[model samples]
Target chain A: MATATGTARTPAPAAPERPDRPGPRAWLSAVWPSALVLLAVLVLWELAAVAFGVSQFVLATPSAIAAETWASRELLLAAAWVTTQEIVYGFAISIAVGVLLAVLIARFHWLDRALYPLVVLFQVVPKVALAPIFILWFGYGLTPKLLLVVVIAFFPITLNMLVGLKSIDSDLLLLMRSVGATRNQILLRVQVPTSLPYLFAGLRIAITLAVIGAVVAEFAGASDGLGYLIQFASTQLDTPLMFSALILVSLLGLALYYGMSLVEIALARRFPHIRADVR
Target chain B: MQSRQISAEGVRMRFGSGSAAQTVLDDLDLTIRPGGFVTLLGPSGCGKSTLLKILGGILEPTSGRVLIGGRPVRDAVGDRQIGLVPQRPALLPWKTALENAGLLRQIATGARGRTETAQAAERALALVGLADARGKLPHQLSGGMAQRVSIARALAMDPAILLMDEPFGALDAITRDEMNEKLAEIWAATGKTIVFVTHSISEAIFLSDTVHVMGADPGRVVETLDIELARPRTREVFADPLFASYSGRLRSLLEPKAAV
Candidate 1:
């Protein structure tokens, strides 16, 4: 969209004088707003906790949560490792199965006709509610948590990828036909490459869902995990540890999100011309 | 495929079945000779683009035939004899300008060696004054530059005929004029048969050797005017008295008249 206006707006001669790459300070500039907001929120919470004389069990202060996280960092880290495994393994399975299902659904009209409504029904079945049943059937091992993760995370991938495959400009299709391109050529050249952005979009949503699913499964029935830690700490009236576990869970999700982004960026750079935004 | 004479003989195109059917094109008959530059000029709903599509073998006519070089449209298309540029550039964002330009030669048939095909695409880019911008991506170039790449993509195939559907319609007026000048130059340089579709009278007059004015409401050709303009038409031709006369005649043919 900026193509027409870009050349007209900026004179070409000035490009040589401009910096080719962004400065190191650019990263700091980008993150400062969010960091400032987070700092302000933490300070406000600590002040309110002290001024109101709230019980530690009710609401742990920011300092207490931080200190507790550092003090028992080993145990918390171990539990975080288990939950991280569940989330990562579950997400990988979701990507494989979801992308396959989407391709199948998009390729065959009869398959789409038969499976779309069923897929929608599965998505709306409330995946978290099924955790107890899965745990009951599969035992309190990693199987139930992984199953829960797949159940919750797979839907968005299939939905976004299928839309991407099906969504092509009609004019582009005509252009392909005019050139007498084969079906295989159109799929490989146009559909699949164009679908990268949508696929990445689905992955972004699915990764978060995978985390939630694993934690919720641990909540329903689990011998280990960050969710189990949270339950144990709450019962022991140790809110600081509960808050620490929660922080770890959030950090795990953040790490997965940025990790996927990095992978996408690397892939985009290696390809014919896929952009870093995955478009 | 090499003869380059494309003709639509008694072609009829209908959109739907039974009473709900709409005839988008009806018994349309026209021929474009080898190395001729023709424009299908009309307002919206005149089925100019549809005719171009039928000629390109992208859409099959409901009743009647479109022949290229005295053979079926399909045969010509299979031989890679038809090159089309749509209204939108439709350049894949993932590819560089050069890659996008050479896409058809790479995909339509692998008969040509990679080196030869790449050189052909590069030559077409040079014809369109885009040799320097070949490394740029679609988003890096201006709208006119992107459309020029599309033209290069079409020309890369060494097709006998070129079909363009308002290739410059999306561009700004200044860019469009620049493109027209470049296109006139390309036509003169290549001497490939071109069937252009557009609603702009000035464009039809400036670039076309023959303008086929079309009428809507059961779309059909109404008038065919031969342009007497010389080769390599420059911007100064816009000031010529003959140019104004041609535009005046085309405008009268195009605009709907109100009943007294």
Candidate 2:
């Protein structure tokens, strides 16, 4: 009994691992096509810019942007560091608060009635439009950026979590209750596990938005960040610099998005029923 | 070992009140003998599931009460004395067959000693002939195998009374028959009382010592017939005149209008 409790789901006598799970070879096969597409897009954009004799101010060539990016690597990297902090902090806060609110709302009908509309209202309002208000309240700092991110990113988390909690089959819940499971037992064993796929779903959406939110927050007013770099470069009319900063922003979003997918994939290994196609 | 006799008295289940009130069950009373195999046979919308839920302590009757071995239904459930197998397999898709079967025992905070409960999972799986399939996940299992794992889960609960609501209803005829045999084997091996809910006449006759034929609107037991058939009923029994007679009687009981 103690051993069973210790390792919740390990087969007793070393059962074979799931054989059909994709390996590195499978992943490479899956990923290489997209990688090739990206390379082709870059090559085409570079050729188009050179052949058209496009002014650098109108559209910097891929090489010019890459050169500018390398030249100002130190400054851009520093701005990336600041932007990374804002997005990470904002994303984290959104998840924690969204999950907490979802639990409360799911458990209590009164709370669902009272607080859910507020949640929806927060979600429906244009968060970028509210950036100015947040700046006015918290000033041009990390605080305003995070508030906007949280305001923008937490809705999907809360809504998805709530749906997950309530979407169980009636028969399943009845079976759980019949087994003498307490409320907490049902929550921990059934509700929590049921909500995980939704958690990942919400997380995927929230992380991407968090990046946008961080940039928007900085756009409102900030001393330093990729967003600030864009504004500064725009004022100097340095298209190469502006293009490089935008590329960094895209890279940040891609990195965060990819990191989340990796985590989701790891989780899906343990809970194989979590469909990768939930998106 | 003392066996639990499940009994219900004056159990009335009504939803809503005033002119809008709708009754699902009314003035229903039942007594299931210890170590007996009983069947609740009824059509759809006949409150069979509701009655089963009431017996399992998953629902409270609008009036009256139920007892298992003289203990209240709620108390029995608290001790994990009532095991339920809903129509759906309800397996945690993430868990392998063994882990899913073992789940009830793991979550059951019953007074049974540690060593006793530890082997319950393995014992139950072996009984259901799933000892080999324990490593397989829910998605990998066939409909019948998944159903067997759920049976194993209920058995692992070590309950006094097992409440199964149309467990094989969703399967094809061949798979359903196979499951019926598997269930019959389990019931014979373990003398635990079982109250199985179903709408199938042959099924009621094949596995049950007594069949409680139920009626639809405001569901109530219209008739209770004891099957004096010999022990270890098999496919051969399906050809017997006695089996045909029992089936005819149950069919009439289920659909009086059609019979008329």
Candidate 3:
């Protein structure tokens, strides 16, 4: 048997200084340059269109898109609202279904093995290809669109939550056991809290996918939404309206992404140790 | 405080399959008196920790029986009187120091109320000199502080029997020494029966009332040495001739090719 060494007495070094906290002015200064760049790009695009004598039918100016947006303010807002509703409803359903599937899969290894291949099959098959079939099956209704959104949004959450639940520290489990903690207590106290970081990571990814899924389904067959508006403008050869609708879609996607990001930030702030990598 | 006796008789442990079965402990017998700080001192793979696990009711012997206060320990689930502190601090990262300490009471008493548990946790944290850091998470704490939290958590249970498996093994020498002093103080105040497992001879000698030397290859107790040191031992006591003599004897006992 090897003798134990008592001489491994190295002291840990002092932790390095954290960077200074940025004030509000510093934060504003950081974003000011990006705003300037955006302004420069818009000005250049508008000027080049006029200078080159490009037809407004083919390439819409930034101002033209803005004018289209202002002229069709009610239409644009209604479409945005419709898209937001689908995204929010789809995202919420995806979370509930994903969490349930993840819990079931985690609880039963055989079920996980059996259904995992099917889940992979669903994820791998492009939603664009599936959209037409979904429309055929469920008709040109919200049901097919919502189902498409669910499909796109569910996989990331299910995979991430499973990984999180399974990756709990063994020592913590042992500690709980040593304390005579019940199985329920172990799950509630240790497993769930430990998985929050990974769960949030998946939620962020899934939220963006929810919007993409909705748009794809809308593109296939829909009477309203920015996707349908974009398609309608394309058929009429109204480039400015198409650009305006496309801009609105991009803004919608950005809003959803930022909303999820803000939630992650709030949770991270509340549970700092859960997000140790953030700093 | 009532004096309770802890005993393990003819304990045996085996792991793995038929052909590859490896025995960890064989026919190990030991007894610890109430208020006695007994250290299981041995080389690595000597099953000192395995013995501690059995004593703490974390594991059951394949054969023989373990008794605490004359009650058999066949299962760990129903027992809340034994407190265990593992080698790693194992403090819950999400919970604050006080919260971690309070978890023991919650586990033991099943949440009658949080107020009493909170008070006990506070007292335990203060006893470990971590009152100022009650709001800090495990990651926010230094390693020494984290270990202290683990100690506080275990102590907050107010168990009659405390089992520590190399609780300060991961600390630096200075931190280890400080922890030893703190443990000694806590032990003095509580008068709890402590079964500390470690491979360090000096540490065993310094903290224990009696040290059980173990041997591997189907591990068993090879020897037990009594330290006749006075109570409330200080750092200066380590320099005394009697302490040196006891340590040398322990070192020699462990270094064999010698008598059991």
Candidate 4:
């Protein structure tokens, strides 16, 4: 709440003096070692490939992969874009549905008791085995890919949200009740804010799985996407192109993962008390 | 605002039924006058906290009834006549001390805008000598200060009765002593009925107009002693011979129970 003082109302603590920036010492201590190790690995691979005179089709060198990546940049970019769209859409839908389901499950004990087991059962069944069923249901379009991602991503989000809702301190609830807080008030001010950290924990895990889910669906059957490119390249013995596609897929996954982290960081900053781990 | 008289008659609280039944409070009876400061001083498991909850309408007694201002406690609670403070401050971590203090006003009317709550909270914080720490979060507060913020929260509600369950129990010796003085002052200033619970004899004698000593094993009130100490009680009062006598009497009452 904004007080008589003019400072803006924020759910979090006062911001730290300097955020999102590391000092030179921190950069040196954390970043340089990893960079040097990556350089060494690339150099070793290039040297070994040259010494063995290995065919690029059998095992593409780092240089060969880089060259192929540059030569087929447009194709790789388009595939990355398609895959990224699938993961983003699937993950977004999962958040909405998962949170809604969690709220309903937490509010009604009978619903939770009756449906929670079935939900867990669904989560446990190998999602990969359901790819064919999803394809049959939604056809070989973006719909199946989205459904697959939602299936994989939704569980953690729902489970974590349920835990968070139920984890409120009983004394706090009692206090709210004593003050005649309506049910909605208790949920908005107490349950939701208290559950933010847990929600973020689930999101961090769900987003990575979403990427994998999209790829798995594409691998099963797809007309476009990095997964399809991988399949097409290997069949034609285009080892360098296959390696490039694989690299692009991993890079896309990393980008999505980091993007989620940035969102989490922004949330953590707004509500510092929600996360003790925030620096 | 006028304070309300609270009466608990034959209040019995049972946890379970049949073979698993456990009667925590058996036929407890008490009366607290309007604007009076009363402390339920007892050991752990004595159901003092339970009794406080019953008075605050957070828990229903298995039998008997509680009334505040000649109305049922449940009805009174809905009217926002009772305010409760638990052992832990339990302030929302996302909110600052001032925001936590203002929470009662926000909930009382289901008001979305917090301007009025903020003004009321500011006054309450000032009453508790926490005006300087309003913007700090619960984690930024010391044990004593956090507890004070809970008190401010309760005070902001402007309830006729304040129900506190061991609000200062977690504080250290020095802070507890300081808090006792502050609470006594606030009680005098506000003239609101306060039902405070604690296990400390000196604390009870130091703050309350009357102390109700309770015993466990089917919790019930054993004795009620009136403290005739003058207003604005000070260190000199603690050193008074009457203070020692009261302390000695309470200790003797608790000693045999402690052995069991």
Candidate 5:
């Protein structure tokens, strides 16, 4: 806050008084209770498998799953790499294409009317249903898998970017016009920067979708990858291996999601307004 | 002293068409002299903003013409001897205070060097008493600070004519008075012709060399009153007899014609 006076201006005091005093360490400490609960649940899961004498074919013990994961570490690591490559490439393509489409749609009302429904239609239809069609068209190769990833990831990016681009405060636009700013200047300086946070939000959602799309495409038809490993384990009745593969898939998704969140945080540091409503 | 004269003749503005057509201003005429601080005082829908837009050459009148320095305003482009401060602060949230102020130079001169632009921006911010806040983003600023940054941006453009549309209307009473004094000082120093639009009678008396009272329902200028107050007017002037007289006259003009 700034206080204005007749002769001078004084900067407002920095300290803000509040009743609830949650320090930085206190905030981090709050997460410990949730972690403890998750640990307890995992313990119960392992105990339950042992107490019921559940067959290894149906329910794998945590130790058994860990052992299997360690045994086939190389294969699992290779598949993880392949899936990461596909996700990275597909996610990059999706962001580029989504932003381009959003800019076009936002710039031209007629284009929006023509293409917006198609985008919604594509998004609503299950990507799993399209995986088979993608395989049929492109065959069992990286192309089909990458295409599936792009398809699944593009919608949220497009919708978020479109909404962000169109969500400009009209008064700001008028101000720019009054300043005699060119169209290009307004777009680059105001519109694009304003939409960045929304774009990053879309990126975070799209990253998880990227992993799912890759796995689904592999499930539909693929010779290698985590999806193939899961399928191989299911056929052999190696439930521990199947559980290990599932865990690897979840970890990969978490990594990518957190990676995007880190980028968003970095950008927000540069542009503080990027912080959402909570701030 | 740099000054620019503005003339708007037989101006008419209409929105939409046919049954949906709404006429905002009809056959309006006004002239602002060089080196003058003129305030447009009106009720809510008096087309003061529309007239400002027309004067700035952002919008052409549906009919008639606007002239800046005896020349048709349509020929003007880019900076065009005009600077505008909208009712809202309208600062770029992504840019810091310094960067936002420097944007005027960037837009006008196509200067890309950061150091030079930063220097100029710092000077403008210092003028507005925001030098310490140069690194702060718009969200980090209070409403008054954001508004001050907006003014600094316009001032940095150094246009011969300044057009402000109720720029301080959003501030609190104390902040508004403070801003008025700062604006008066700046105007005194720069001697740039200013046309300000406001709904407040006291604000008009406090800041303007002359006040133009306008009426709504096909917005038109109803009267103009001259304020012969001395230079470097302080906040105390708000309680002066001349200020009261000018405000009382404006109140009378606005009251009887008031709708409902």
Candidate 6:
């Protein structure tokens, strides 16, 4: 047991060395193909709109949309900021509530049985249907929009958290228990750390859905936001402006989604065992 | 740490309820002296692992009881007198080798500080010849390396008794041999009572001072043989004439039970 060869034994195949992180060249190589595809699609759209003599009101060319976006830069930027704020606030609240409820439900069987069905039902019901109700209750302020975002975004987070908490290895649990570890110790030291990957998975899904929720709530009724701006542009028969607003909404969603990814990456680095896989 | 005596008094374990219930371990009785190395050798479904669990106080017997250090097994467990190594290493993947080794310190005292806990773990790792690999994660460890870490984790507690459920059952033949030799050395040095469970006949004969051959289908000990081999029993012992007799007797005892 005290021999040097015993300590010098080779690592098992099951426990392979950690993979190297992708370098700058690898990053550029991955990005450029997708970038070329997007460029090609834009060129095709511009040619199709011009060749077919499509009216700008019916289908604006990519160039027309870009020009309109540049002309209304201040208005678009301000609206994007409002929608971005709603997305961030609503997303943060959703995460907090979702994790809390998940813990409560997962920790107690009776609570889970009582609330799980109702949660599933709520998740199934089109959250857009609740947008008008939120508007009725909270009026045209940010509260209604934020509530709508929470309702839509909270389910995935809750379900994923439950999955994560419950998915611990039975053997690991037994190992901890054999050492006389208390219930709380087992939970905090074992279960919570094990569930981090699943939690991140849910966060990615919830974040993207939050952007959609904010847009739907704005469509129902809002004084300012990309969704409201899109509705206004549509009413004025300004197709290019509507497209620009739609573009801004997507851009906001992309930013928030990648923001979650960045957090996930940093966390995975800190605890490499739960390296959250890219969604 | 000095060794502790362990005994199971007519222990029985049953699964299910009423008439539909099946007995896994029935009227099983065992006793081990302090500083003894004993192996419960049996085939699969023999409930050897279940018996080990009962002795460790992780599972209560359906009837009867286990006693360690002249106290109820449950009490002994409460005092953290036993260290158990299951079939798998079961190390927390998020923790490094040293951290995994020191896990018992946290459980033993609820001590959240890392400094003292780390020193204890480091010492245990060195005993298991894994001091150099302390910083590696479980994923970076080989099967034998991971098992060594698990053993170190148990040793860090300096428990009175070590209960292993086929700790090397997953390793290749060569690694298993190496582990057996290392375990023998640890046993000689520490003199801790060890109750190991394994199905391999040669394994039982090689390391154990006494082998309790257990029969399956409601597991119970069928025979016990005192290994009269000389001290520092090495690989060359396999060539000894007495070793063949012990192996033959153990095999004969197992075959008749297996046929039933």
lDDT of 3 by residue, A53-111 (tens): 99988899999989988999899889888888888898999999998888777767898
| Model 5 ranges off by over 4 Å | A1-28, A108-110, A277-279, B1-3, B77-79, B112-120, B256-260
Q: Return the lDDT, model 4, position B232.
A: 91
In candidate 3, what are the lDDT values of residues B23-84, reduced to their tens digit?
A: 99999999999889999999889999989888877787899889877878643335567778
lDDT of 1 by residue, A223-264 (tens): 889999999998999999999999999999999999997787
Better of 1 and 2 by TM-score: 1
> Where does model 2 exceed 4 Å of error?
A1-52, A276-279, B1-3, B110-115, B256-260
Candidate 1: segments with Cα more than 4 A from true spot? A1-24, A270-279
DockQ ranking from best candidate downward:
4, 1, 2, 6, 5, 3
DockQ of each: 0.45, 0.44, 0.20, 0.50, 0.27, 0.38
Global lDDT for candidate 6?
0.86
Docking quality (DockQ) of candidate 1 = 0.45
CA lDDT, every prediction? 0.87, 0.85, 0.82, 0.86, 0.82, 0.86
Model 1 TM-score relative to the real fold: 0.92
Candidate 6 per-residue lDDT, tens place, A1-279, comes to 111112213333333334435778888999999999999999999999999999999999999999999999999999999999999999999999999888888777898999989899888798889999999999999999999999999999999988998988787788788877777787788877787888888998999999999999999999999999999999999999999999999988888888887776666654655553311
Indicate whether candidate 4 or candidate 5 has the larger TM-score: 4
Give RMSD to native, each candidate.
3.8, 3.8, 7.0, 3.1, 4.5, 4.5
Record all residue pairs in model 6 with backbone atoms less than 3 Å apart, i.e. clashing. Answer: A11-B142, A12-B142
Summarize candidate 2's per-residue lDDT along B1-260 as a digit string, tens digits: 26488889999999988999989999999999988899999988889899999998888999989988888988888888878898989888777787788777776755454555557878988999988777776766789999999999999978777899999999999999888988999998988889999999999999999999999887999999998788787788999999999998888777656544
Model 1 lDDT tens row, B1-260? 35768888999999988999999999999988989999999999999988998998888999999988899999988888888899999898767777888888887767656888889888989989988777766766788998999999999988888999999998999999999999988888888999999999999999999999999988999999999987678888899999999999999998885758
Residues B1-260 of candidate 4 have per-residue lDDT tens digits of: 44378999999999988999988999998999999999999989999999999999888999999988888998888877788889998888767889889987788866664777788899999999988888876766788989999999988877888999999888899999999999989998988899999999999999999999998888999999999888899878889999999999999987754354
Leading candidate by DockQ: 4
Residues forming the 10-long window of minimal summed lDDT in candidate 6 chain A: A1-10
